[model samples]
Target chain A: MKMLGQKNNRDNREGLKGWLNPLRYGWERVSYWLQRLTGIFLLVYFVGHVFETSSLVGGRNAWDTMLEMTQTTWGHTFLIMVIGASTFHSANGIRLIFTHVGIGLGKPGRPDYPYYPSSLNTRQRSGIWIALILTAVAMLYGANVLLGGD
Target chain B: MRELDNMTVKSDKKAGCDPRDDSFDLKKTTLRVFRTNTAQGKDSHFDSLVVPVQRWTTVLDSLLYAKSYLDSSIGIRYSCRMASCGSCGMKINGIPRLACYTKISELEDPVVVCEPLPNFPVIRDLVTDFTQFFNHHKSINPYIQNLNYDKTEKIDEVSSSHSHRQSREEVDKYLQFSYCIKCGLCYSACPTVATDTKFPGPQALAQLYRYYADSRDAGKNRLNIVDDRHGLWRCHFAGSCSKVCPKGVDPALGIQLLRSYMLGISKDKRNV
Candidate 1:
């Protein structure tokens, strides 16, 4: 018994754009969005790295030419971004793995008023902050190696 | 302090002295309500209405005010005028929330925007269809099953004798999830449900976990119900479902816990 005018796929669905915006819901949402964007960024970088490595068959001159292109300020900045993305991705990914296993999150209790979700407790939120801090440190180190004092 | 409706009132104190002095500052505000008429061949658009307000005025109150004197045809569903019925759910100020639960002053914006909850079809102005949403909930087998039902001597005895009993500890396992009002706020807030139509949104998945974790439930095949491609596995833990849940049901946690059950991480099956 399907009702007419009740069909889905209407213009109402937010479609792909919904993935882009994290809103003010929680840090977990920002983690989700960042994880996705970083995954894509890593994937693109992975393919480019493979191509750069395969250029080794072209001998010393060709390899040096590739290195010369990548050894620029813009290239180093992009590498730093990759470092930050990967660091955040892996750190948050571990937290997600722990969460997915039903660990760390507190037990399901009675949902009293002004209810704070048991899953998003202090421990889990601290995990997010830890991941962010770890990413900042990794990105700084990467900047030092690529574009900074080094 | 003199009362001036649900708005801010000056208590003869200077403005800067009180950091909470947003009172009485906003007397009238504009409401950008979304409107869509399929019958009239009109596209979706926001209908702006400047309505007066008080401090305790909710988004629903503003809409009602506009409906009474401004326009008689604005389609908005509400019952109980409280957060109980879960009918007045809409995106207020770009966030999915219960209209009755959200106060206009809390928005902190001159123009409050009201749109139908996303991830569902718009039936009319600020009214989204819940057909598919309900169907997903139904597909997960939201109720408990009694293995004693088949061997029962009489159907009448099922209610009294066949009824399942539990201790306080057992009750707490699934009690938190039962508070869901099915407001569709979590469904709209979910990014997975935004694009994936097959994924059974958080409400349904959480309800599934509720039944699956119940000590009285004899349905051994509960985990396998959503063990398919479009099942609970699609949930990547975005957690907006729990964040936007008005009742604090934490559907995302329920989904994750259900996954643990499915993966055999918890060997203590209550029915076993």
Candidate 2:
């Protein structure tokens, strides 16, 4: 079957700009991209975490050295990033759950000219706001813990 | 003359223009339209043209004006200039909108960027090939499959039976989804369809749910049709399909309801 938007050689001239056009979309699209990105980051981090923790099998000295490396500035920054991704992923996951369960969807209405917002639309917007707020709060707490003067 | 007068009046009301006004407005607007002509071997490019736009001038009207008066080479597919035909679906200022329904004045941007709907093969400037969209829509068997309909009876006479009659409440169940004009706008706006071509897409899946939700439909095995891979599970519920739908058919909501049904959690009263 012929697929739509299958890029030919001429169409292939444009690089990542087509998929990653930052200026062409709205906040919902931004959140969608970020959720995928964070999920990827979490997957990579999970593998690295398992490997890092496996250092304990090499004896107490190896474990101690691995722990020591995680206390530095760069390590703290990486940990903060991990915290942010986890928080955002969890919050957004909740939102996805709500959508999948049809929590906010009621009677579908006619799309008014000039665009009237629906109940599901409002719920999705609030979900994004809540996710953003939770991510902010989690990031700030992580930053305070890592950057605080002892 | 009378028919033309009636048409003008009806179109004016549909376009949200004052019917009393006979003269077209002289206000000009900038349109940055994507242009491509494979037959002419011309590379895809953005062409900007300034055209006079009235308060009632739709995006489709502006394109028509540009084609007729300014550039004759530009290609666009449109018919029935009303929203009913579903032929004028395009990305107006990065949103999948029906060109016939979108007013030029309503767009807040100074320069309106017109592009072909995303996730579809561009045939030319603002023209997309909808063959695959229709194929996928057809794959789901969109018609109401009444397994109980006796082939021995005349087709029209089958409705004479009182059992085939649906209550007002039963009609209300799938009534919202019956409004789908199959514009492919939902397919364009769907992020899943953008990446995964194997997915049945929002339009098809929504139609599947529409038929499944109908009380008169005796297709009890319908739920299992979309239960396979790249079906109900592929939709991530980005909600873009519902948001950009010109007809207000919330395909995202339909997909979610289908998902809930699959998971045995749907509150929908319809028995499978």
Candidate 3:
């Protein structure tokens, strides 16, 4: 995040076109916070999962009862949110990895100024398309599951 | 008495003068150290203390005194009291350095500032999570690979001259960086490692280059191992790692060398 600040803060703060015009800063913060939050969430989930699995020490009945409670409405809904957040966090992390190493999606001959173009080419826009597609699929599945269709 | 190297105070008496005429008292100094714990919930606050500073007193010495006398539960880590153990590294006045090696009296101000090493999870006051550092070190396979199989045949030791000649400069490069002690000061100082965990880090990358430089080792695929986007490419040459290295090992140079090696810019890429 400091690296981004060093390179982009001047341009980042100067923009006033619209709320969406300077989306990179918002996205960067969101991704960072979400990744950290999701990581903590996963850690908590792991601890709870291990504790729940320890119910096997009691008997098969305990394990079955716990499983039934976990498959209840609230539990299922929480699981869905976890899956979605985890996936988004992972994708954003990978993207960050690429960007940090100077992997520009733009062509080699293109000028480096004004990092993002006014219009993105097919290659430049592929990652966004992929993320949108994945989100759409996940939303559809989530609605289906909640509607008792899956 | 002759003045010791790096000593700031001078003896008042000349060669034949009486010692009783002059007196020396310890200098009163204030230390400002960052304070936090799990119960405190990450809102780090500063705590200050005044102590008498002597010529040979180290920052760690003051910290120890504070912990034992001032506050027993002031969390910190230390192993071998000497700098060899590397467990006592932290940020002193915004620079990551071994606390054991830094003298308290030499600092510009008595108001000493301290913080946990950056680029790592802080466990408590001065104690940081070194799990990531150790894991990265292990990832490079920090050992000699034994390839020869002998049922009965025993091979004589290779000539030291041959091995020595090949790795002379390479050994110098490795020898300095190899003394990292896993203290993680370089990792803390490095901006690249701070932002990107997958960057292999300056310490690990230096060790990576060390393995590639070994004459006994044939690491042909070394370049391939760390050539990815998450590897050498992420280093932006901030030079912070070199600035704070307690062992005087320039990890920034190692990362640069690795980058040049990956980009085919150096003449001795194979030799690293």
Give fnat for candidates 1, 2 and onward, in order: 0.63, 0.20, 0.00
State every prediction's TM-score relative to the real structure: 0.90, 0.85, 0.56
Q: State residue A53's C-alpha deviation in candidate 1, in Å.
A: 0.4
Model 3, B80-147: lDDT tens per residue?
A: 77888889998887667888988987777758988887676777887877776777777677764434
Better of 1 and 3 by DockQ: 1
Q: Each prediction's DockQ?
A: 0.45, 0.29, 0.01
lDDT for each residue of candidate 1 in B1-272, tens digit (9 for 90 to 100): 33563235244334422335644354899999999976677888888899988777899999999999999899999987889889999999888999999998788999999999999888889988888888888777789886767673676777677766788888888888888888999999988888888777899999988888788888877777688777878888888888888898999888888887777776675521
Q: Which of the two, 2 or 3, has more DockQ?
A: 2
Ranking by DockQ: 1, 2, 3
Clash counts per candidate, in order, are: 7, 1, 0
Mark the regions of model 2 whose C-alpha exceeds 4 Å error after superposition: A1-27, A107-119, B1-25, B155-157, B267-272
- Candidate 2 per-residue lDDT over residues A1-150, each given as its tens digit: 222443222221122333465334456666777788899999999998998999999999999999999889999899989999999999988888867766676544444555432424767778888898899899899999898866
Candidate 3 or 2, higher TM-score: 2
User: Cα miss at B147, model 1 (Å)?
Assistant: 2.3
Which residue pairs clash in candidate 1?
B6-B54, B6-B55, B6-B56, B7-B54, B7-B55, B8-B23, B8-B24
i-RMSD of model 1 (Å, 1 decimal): 3.4
How far is A15's C-alpha from truth in model 1 (Å)? 1.6
